[model samples]
Target: MGQGARSSWGRLLADLGSTLLEVVHGRIPADRPVGGVVIHDPVDEPVYPENSLVLAVGVHTPDALAPLLTGAGRNGGIAVIVRSPVDLTDDVRRAADDAGVAILGLARGATWTQLAALLRSMLAEDDIGHTQAESLDGIPAGDLFAVANAISALLDAPVTIEDRSSRVLAFSGRQDEADASRIETIIGRQVPDRYAQVLVERGVFRDLYQSDRPVVVDPIEMDEVVTQQRVAIAVRAGDEVLGSIWAAMDGPVTPERAATLREAETLVALHLLRVRAGADAERRLRAELVSRAVEGGPEARDALSRLGLAGRRVSVIAAAALPDEDGDASEQADQERMAARELLLDALTMHLSAVQPGAAVAFVADTAYGIIPVADAAAEDRSAALSEDFVRRISGRIPAVVAIGHAADDVAGIAASRAEARRVLRVLTTRAGTRRVARMADVETESLLLELRDLRASRGETASGFLARLVDYDRRTGSELVNTLAAWLDNFGDVPAAAAATFLHPNTFRYRLRRVAEVGEIDLTDGDTRFAAMLQLRIRRD
Candidate 1:
C-alpha cells in the first residue's frame, strides 16, 4: 500500500509539474487555475470562489501541523505545513525536509505559483502560433501555386486576366486547343468588346467586376456559340479591384464545379495582383523620380547627370488616361491602364523622334512626355506647335486627353516651361474659365514693367484721361483734328502712319494733321498731343 501510494503521488507530481508549467506559461486560458494552493494559520477561514484558489497554513510545530498538511495534499489541497522533528530546523521543515510528499512545505506552495506563471507563458506562445498560422492561411505561397496549377489544369476551360479596359494580360487553360491559340493571339491585346457594354448586353465582365466574390455564369443562359461557360473571380486587394480572372468552360457551369474552381481562381487572381503590385510599385517609384527631376531644374539635371542623360533639352507633355466611352471593362482594367501609359509614351517618342533627331521621350510619372533640343529657338516653337498638332492627330486615333507644353531652349527652362504648359493645359482642357494662351514674352521683365506702368497710370489722371477725352470727341464729331494730331506725332509730328490708323488716306490724313492746328487744342505735331493720342489708342481701344 505504501509503494502504491508513492507511485500515485509520483504520477500526480509529474502531471502537476507539466500542467503547472503550461498554465503559468499561459498555454491555457488566463482565468484557469494552474493548481490549488492553501495558506493556513489565519484567524478567519478565507473563502475562494469555485474557480479561484486559496492557500492555508497552520501556525504550529511538527506535532501540531502534520494532520492538516497531510490531509490537504491527499485531498488535492495544498498547505503551508510546519514540522519539528529530528535534526530538521524550522527552515528545513518549511522546505518539508525529511517529510514525505504528503507533507508539502512553503517551497511546495511556491511551486504552484511557479506553475501558474508557466501556464501564462505557454498561453503567449499559443497566441503567437495562432497568429502565424492565420497569416499563412491568408497568403500561403504553396497553397497559391497549387491553386493556380489546378486552374490551369481544367480540361474544357480557358483562363484570362483583364484590366479595366478589358485588355488581356494572361490566358491559360483552354478546353479547345484552337481557343488557346486564339486567346494567345489576344494576349496583350485589348478585348475589342467594351466591358460595360458586355455587362449591359450579356452581363459577363461587368457582373464579374462588380462581384466581390466568385461568379458562375450558366452556359445555357449565355450564347452557346460564343460564350459556352464562364467562372470568374474579382481580383480585389484592399478597396481596389484590379481586374479579374475568368475561366470559360465549353459547357454549362454546375454549382459544385463552380465552387471547386472558385478557390483556385481566387488564388490565381491574388497571385497575379501581388506580382503586378510589386512591379507597379517599382515603376511608380521610377516614374516619380523622373517626374520630380523634370519639374525641379538643377536638381532634375543633377539626377539626369547621375543617370548619364545630362545636358539634353527635353520637352514635356501631359496625357490623361481614362476609360473609353463605350466599353465594359471587368477583367483587364489594370493591364489596359499599364498598356495605355506605355503605348502613349512609345507613341510620343516615335512621333517626336521622327521630327527631331536625338529627341528623347518618356513617361514622367503618370503622364506621357517628350524632350528634345532643336536647332533654333524659333524652330523649337515650330516643333512644339507641330508636336501639339501631332498630339491632336494621335489623340484622334486613340482615346486619350493630350496636352503639350511649350518647348524650352535648355534644361534650365524645363521646370518653368513645364509649369507654363500645365497652366495652358488647364486652360485648354479643363475650360474652367476664359483663357489667354500663356507666352513667356507676356510675362517677361519688360512686359511686366509695362503692365505695372499701365496699372499705375490707370489709377491716376495721367495719359489715359487725356487720350480718352480726345478719342471721345473724335467719335462724337467727324474729327480730322484728332487724326491729324495722331498722324503728325506718329510721323514724329509728321502726317503719316497715324493718319492711316485713323482710317484716312496718307495725303488726307496729312490734311487732318494740318487741321489739328486750326481745331480745338495744341499744335497738330506737338509732342504732348502725340503722346496723348498714342496713350488713347493703347488704354481705351476696344
Candidate 2:
C-alpha cells in the first residue's frame, strides 16, 4: 500500500525542526495542509500562491508584513514564516490570527534555502508514494457505503455525503477525528449556521454549484466556531445537482485524491436518485391513507392502524392562504405562493414531529391538513397551544388562516372533525380582521347563527314584522329608534343604561322610547313582546 500525496502543517514543522525554525506567535493548524514553500522578495511585486507556506526571509516591518499577510490571505496561502531579529508588530500578529494563518519565526543562523529544500523533499516523497497506488478506473455504483469507505481509505480522512440542502445522508464512522461542527452536522442533519456563514462568504457553495471539479476550503476559525480543511465535490446528474461528497482533509489533497473524489461523486448521484424514487412511493402511500381517513371510508380505521395510530384520539387542522390585497395574481406571484406553501408545510412537519412522533400532515386542495394525535385529556390542549404558536410564527411569512377541529376519539370520527375544521375555515375567510388561528369550539355561537340564517333563507321567510317596521321607520325618517331598541334589548331592557350607552339624557331617552313603541305599535312592558323583539333583532344582525 502507498501513501497519498498529502502532508499536514504539523508534519512540515517536525521535518524542518533541525533547520533552526521555531514557531513564535500563532500555533500551527495541524489539520491544514502546506502544499509547498515559497521565498518572499521585497523588491518584486508580491504574489501569494494558494496552499503555499510563504517565507519572509529578511522583511520584518509591520508595513511590509501587513500587505504580504493580507495578500496571502486573499490568495488562500497557509502560513508565513519570518526570520528572527526582525521586529514584529501587534497589528501583524492580530492580522494573521484573524485570517487563521499561522506565523512562525526562524532561529538565528537558519537560511530560507535550507528550509525550502526540506519542504520540497517531503512533498516529493509524498508524490512518489501516491504514484504507486491503484488507478482510479472504476467505482462501484450499487453500494454507497462501500464507496464512502473506499474514499475515506484512499484519502486517509473522514468523509461525509450530504444532500444539496446540506443534510448529511452518510458519514464515515470516524467520530474520533470529527470536530464540534462535524458532530453537530451529523446529529442535527444539517450544517450549523455559523460554519455555513463562513463557507458562504468564501464563495465555496458558488464554486461547487458552478463547477464539476473539487473545491478546496482552508481552515476556518470564527469567534467560537472552527473547522478543519475540507474538499467538496458536487454530485450531479446531468445539470441537476443531486448532492455532495465532502472529504475532511488533514493535509493537502493531491491530484490523485481529487480525481478519486470526482469518481465517488458519480456513485453518490446514482444512489440519491434511487433513494428519491423510494421516497416518492412512500409519500404516495401516506397521501392515500390521509385521503381515505378524511373521507371516512371503510378502510380508514385499518389504514390508521397500519400507520401505527390505532385507537388514538385525533384532531384535524386546515390552513389556507388568505387572498392578497393588491391582487397581483401574476405568474411570479403564483410561483411565490407555491413556494410559500411548501415552506409552511415543511415547517409544520418539523414542528409536529418534534412534539409528537407519527403525526400525519398532508396538503390537499391548496390547504395543508394535519392529523395530530391526542393521547390524553391534556394532549388536545397542548397541541392546540402549539398549533397557535406555529400559526403566529408563520403568519408574517405566509398570510394564512388556520382552523382546528374538536378532538375525536377514533379514526372513524376523523371525517366529522375535518368537516368542522372546514366550516370554521370558511367563516374565517369571509370575515376580516379575525385572529389567524381559531378552533371550532371558539366559533360555536357564530356557527349556530349561521345555521339559523341558512334555515330562514331556505324557507324564503322575511324578518319578523316588528323588526321590519323598526328598520323601515329608521331608514325613512333618519331616526335613532331602531338602534336604541337594539341597545335596550342587548342590555336586558335597562332604560337608564341604554340611555347612558347611547349618550342621551334619561328623560330624552324615555321620550324617544315612547315614540319607538308608538311608531312600531308594540308594547314595551310585555315580557313576551320584549323576548320576541330581541330575537328578531339578533337574527337581523346576523
Candidate 3:
C-alpha cells in the first residue's frame, strides 16, 4: 500500500480513539448508538457520524510509557498523555521531537486537544517518511499514485507514465483489452527518437518549467500517430527532467481533464525524478561495459554480450552537421541525430530477420557516431538498393553528410572498422563538405593528391621532396599537382599526352613525373607503388 493509504488508516484510527474517549468520559448522550456502523459523504465514505464525541486516555506520568501503547493509541484514534516513565527516556523525547509529536506532560492528565494534535503529528511524519523512501527507488509510487488517482477522480480519464527515454512504464487507470494490448506493445519500448532528441536539444525542459500550460500536440503536427493516445506531459524534477506521462482519452480535454492533468503533472515530476535516478545508474553501468568492450579485445566479447550485441557483423557510420545546415545545432533541436539512431535500429530488425542485431549509436548535436550490424555481401547485396532507397528518403527530409564505414564481418573487427570509418568521416568533412557520401577507400586518394599538389606548389623543391613538399607547397602556393598526377594517370602515364592535356611541355612533364616519384618518396617502377600512387591521385581528382 502507498503512503496515502497508510495515512488514511491512521486518521481512521485517531477518529476511533477520540470517540472512545468521549464515551468513557460520559461526554456522549446514552441514546447515541456506539456499536453500529455509520456512513457519511458518498465521495469519501467516511464511515461515521461527523458529530461523534472523541475520547482521551493515558493522562499521567508520560502516559502509555510502553512503545506498543503509544502505537495502539494512534491505531485506536485517541489522544494519550506523555509523562516521564521508565520507557520515556531522553532518546524517546528526542525521537518524538524529531517526528514533531508534541509531548503533553499535563499535571491534571491530558486533554482531548493534546491527544488529537499528537495523532495528527505522528500521521504526518509517517507520510513524509514514506515519501523519503520512494525517492530512493527512482519511482515515487506514492506521489504518482496520488496524482494518477487524483486525475482519474477529477477527469475520469486514465493517465500513463513514460520515462526519460520515452518508454511507457505503467498506466494510471484500468484499460480496455485492446488498449491494454497497445500498452503492452509500447511498455518497455523506447520513445520515438525524434521526440527524445527534440526534448534533449530544444530546451524542452525550460519550456516545461517556465509555463503552466499543457503541451498540446496534434497528430498532424507530429506527422505520425504511432500510438492511440495523443497527449503527453513531460515530468520534471527541479532543474532536472525525468520523463513524461501521456493520456489517451476519447474526447478533447474538458475542465475536469485540465484539472486532472495538472495534478498528474506533479506526481509525474516526482516519479520521473525517482525513476531517472535508477535509469541514470543503469545507463552508467551500460556505458562502462561498452567502454570496456571497446578496450578489452576478446574480453570485450563479454561486454558485447552485456550490450546484447555479441558475435555479429558490424557497420560503423560517421556523420556530421554542416554549418550550412539550418535549424538547431544543440542536441535538443537535432531530431535527425535521434531519428537516425532509431531508423537504423528499426531498419536492421525489419531487413535482417536471421541475424541478432546490436547497435550503439550516439547523437552529439553536430555529429553522430554509430555502430550497427550488416550481414554478408550476399545478404546485403540484394538489399543495398532497398537500404539506399531508405537512406535517400530520410536524407531528403534531413540534410546531412553520412559516410558508411567498412563493415566488419564479426565482432572481432568492430573496433578497427569504427576507427577507419571515423577517419574517413573526418576527411569527408574537410574535402566533401556536407550533403555527400564518402567511402574509406576513397579518402586515401584525396590525402595523396593533397600531398602531390603541395609538392608541385613549392618552388624548386627537390625531386625527393616532391610528395612531402607537395603537402607543404600546396599550403604555400595552393597549386594542383594531384590533379596533374590524376591527368597523367588517366592518360596511362603517357608523358606527352599528360603534358599536352595539362597545357605543359614535354620537358616540364618529365620533370614533374620524376619529381612525383621523388616527392612521394616511393618508386613508381614497382606495380604496387605505382598502383597506390595512381589510385590516390585518381580518387582525389574525382
Candidate 4:
C-alpha cells in the first residue's frame, strides 16, 4: 500500500455493510477521505487525527454528537461513527452539516476493534491499487501545469496553485467548473479581499500553515460566491509551506482523490522550489547591477545596458528609515528594523517595476537605492507620484524617507543622479518634520548650500568674521541683533516686514539693525556682504 492512500466515509461504511454501521444524520462525505480510524472513549481525551473517520464507541446521544462533531471538526477529524442506538436530532444533524463532519451509526454487535482492523485492511488494498495505477501512467514529475490538470481530472474539479501569500501562480484552465471566487482569484493573480477574509475568519489559513494534511472547507456555510467545496493541500518543503494546491470539489473528497492531491502537492513543492531559486538568482543579478551603477564602477554602463537602461532617461531614488522617536536600540529592535527595511525595499522594487519596466532596486547599507528608467518627461512625474504612493503605503508600518533625484539622459548620468539623491537623503534625515518624499529639484538651493558648506569645512574655513562678531555681541548683551539681521536679510532687506515678522516696532528694528552694523564693524548697505552673511547665518542655524 502507498503511504499516501486514504479511504472515504461512504466506502468504509459500505465495506462494513448494514450489519456493522449505517448512515444516520449527515450523509457520508463521499469524496472526503478517512486516513485512519479512532475509537472515541468518554473517560479519555479525544484524539482527532488528520483525515480520520472517528468511531464513537459508547456514547451516541443527540446532545453528545453536537459537541463531539464540533470538537472533531476543530481537531481536524473528517467524520464520526456512533455505535450506540440513540436517535439523532435535527440540531445535531445541522451542526454536523455546518461543520462538514459526517455522522454514521454502528449497528449492534459491531466491536470498535473489529471495525478498525477491517478499515485498515480495506484502505491498504485501496492504496495498493492506487500506487500501481500511479506508477503506470500518472502525472509526469516537475510539470506544474500537468500536476494541476491531473488533480482536476482525478477529482472532476477546478484547481489552482497559489503561493503562501494567496497569489495565484497557476490554474488548471478549468474555468467552466470554477466559482466566482476562484475565477476572480485567477484573473487578479490574488485572492480577493472578501474571500480571503472569510477564510481567515474560519481559521482555514491557520490550519494550512500549522498542519501537513489537506484541509477540507465546507462551502455550505461560506459565502454564496464560493459555490463549491474546497480542499487545500499545503505544498511543503520539509517544515516550510512553499505554497498550496486548491481543488474545487462538487461533492465530498474521496480517498483516491485525496491521495492524488497529496501526490500533486509533492510535485508542486518541487516545482516551486526550482522557481524560487531561479527568481532569487535573477534578483541577485539585478541588485548587483544597480549597486554597480550607483557606485560608478567602469562596468556600470554595461550593467545598465544588461538591465535595458543603457540609452533610457533615468532617475535614482534613495529610501531610508527614519529614526524612532523613543530611540529603541535593543538587538530585537535592530533585527525587526532590518526585516522591515528588507520588506519595504522589496515592495518598492515591485511598485517601481509596475510603474516603469526594468526598474532596478537594491538595498545598500541602511538605504535602499533604485535606478528607474523614465520613458519621457511625463514619466518623471509618474515616478515621483509612484514613489510617494509607496511611501504612504508603508507609513506607520515603517516610517521612511524617500529622496528622488533629477532625471538624466542615459546610463552615464546614473552616478550624478544617485549622488543627488543621496545628498537629498542626507538633508532629509537631519531636518525635523521634513516631508516623506524629497526631490532634488525642490531642494536645489539647499543642496547647493550644503555642498558649499562641505567644501568650506574640508578647507578648514570658519564662519564669516563679521557674522561671528554679531553673534558674539548678541551673546554678551542678551540682545536680538543677530536674529534681527537674519530676519532682515530673509525678508529681502524689508525693514518694516522683517520688524513685523520679529514682532518689533519699525523704529526698534531699525535701531537693532544700526547696532548690528556697529557691533559687526561692516557695511550693511553692500549687497554682496549681506548675501555672504545671510548664507553664513543659514548654514549655522542647525
Q: Which candidate is the best by TM-score?
A: 4
- Name the 10 consecutive residues with the lowest summed lDDT in model 1: 1-10
Tens-digit lDDT string for candidate 2 (1-542): 11232467776566455344667666766777666666787678455545777888767788888777776767677678887754667888778877767677776533354355445545444331113222122433234566677778877888888877888777876745967778888788788887888889999999998888998888888666667888999987545677888888767668898788876776566555445533443455566667677667787887677566668888888877787778788999989888888888778878888987888877776777888888776988887788788878787887778788878877657889988988888766656765777888777666666767778989998865767787788889999888888878888878899999999998888888888898888998999999878777766677
In model 2, which runs have C-alpha deviations exceeding 4 angstroms?
1-147, 150-156, 163-169, 175-202, 218-229, 250-259, 273-287, 313-352, 356-358, 366-368, 372-412, 424-443, 457-464, 519-529
Tens digits of per-residue lDDT, candidate 4, 1-542, equal 33343656665565455445666666555666666666777688756667877777666577887888887777777778876564777888777888778777665534454455445555544321123221112443235677677778876788899888899887886866767777778889898887788899989999987876789987834453445788998876544677899988766667887788877776676566445433544565567677887777788887777777788788999998887777899999889888898888888888887877888888877889988888787888888888889889888688888999888875557788888899999877767775888897777777777878788889998765887798777788899888999999989989999999999999999999999899898798898888888888887774
Cα lDDT, all candidates: 0.48, 0.73, 0.49, 0.75
lDDT string, candidate 1, 1-542, tens digits: 01011112232234333322111111223233323333453465444222222233334454545444344434444223232122234643443322222232232212332323222222222121123321122544224433433666753455666566666666654435434323533653565443335555767666776665567655432233443445667765433465666666555566656665655544554554445433443344445445755687556765555434466655555555445545557568667777877876777667766877755455765656545565467766766576556656666555555444566545667777666555444434333222222343433433333454568677884543445455566778967565455455556644456655676677876566554544445543456655656655434321
Which model scores highest in lDDT?
A: 4
Error of 2 at 309 (Å): 2.7
Q: Global CA lDDT of candidate 3, please? A: 0.49
Q: Which lDDT tens digits does candidate 3 get at residues 261-351?
A: 7656665654543343344334444545555554447666776776667777766665554333355588766665567555543453343
Cα-based TM-score, every candidate: 0.43, 0.58, 0.41, 0.59
Clashing pairs in model 4, backbone N/Cα/C closer than 3 A:
31-252, 31-253, 31-254, 32-252, 32-253
lDDT of 4 at 98: 81
Kindly give the stretch of ten consecutive residues in candidate 4 with the minimal lDDT sum. Answer: 127-136
TM-score of 4: 0.59
Count clashes in each candidate, considering only residues at least 3 apart in sequence or on different chains: 54, 0, 32, 5
